[model samples]
Target: MATVIFTKNLERHLSCPSQQVSGTTVREALDNAFSDNDQLKSYVLDDQGRLRKHMLIAVDGSTISDRIHLSDSVNEQSEIYILQALSGG
Candidate 1:
């Protein structure tokens, strides 16, 4: 199982705890994490099922390249981090 972690900044808005989920891709792992929490899923994804512009997901230590599809691969021991992207100058 891969570990999915949400930043503390996002925790302020909802109940998001680090959870271990099963998946080979970022989308699968995220879907697993959000399976029980539709609200969290909405916060992270838009109506088109694409990653929201303000959100970012990183596999291991490198940021993912496919935000729309979240096709980044993950291993059993991979660390997946989901966080709100900072903005402004």
Candidate 2:
């Protein structure tokens, strides 16, 4: 099972915790992580289900390749990290 961890900043705003879940794709892995927190889903994904612009996902130290569908593969030992993207003017 892959492990999903929300960054400290995100975890402070939301209550999502690090979890080990089963999935083959990034979407599936995230789905398992969000299964208990629907509110977190809205923060991470938009109405169309694409990753929100303010957020980013990294799998095994690399940013996900498919933001539109989260089709990036996640193996059993993968470590997935969810983080809030910072913006500056």
Using TM-score as the measure, the top candidate is 1
**How good is model 1 by TM-score?**
0.97
lDDT of model 1 at position 76: 98
When summed lDDT is taken over every stretch of 10 residues in candidate 2, the lowest stretch is: 29-38
Compared with the true structure, the alpha-carbon lDDT of candidate 2 equals 0.93
Over the stretch 1-89, how does candidate 2's per-residue lDDT look in tens digits?
A: 99999999997898988999999999999888888888999999998889999999999999998999999999999999999989999
Question: Residue-wise lDDT of candidate 1 within 1-89, one digit each (tens)?
Answer: 99999999999999999999999999999999999999999999998889999999989999999999888899999999999999998
RMSD (CA, Å), each prediction: 0.6, 0.8
Clashes of 2: 0
Give per-residue lDDT, candidate 1, residue 1: 97
Most accurate candidate by lDDT = 1
What lDDT does each candidate get? 0.95, 0.93
Candidate 2's error at 85, in angstroms? Answer: 0.7
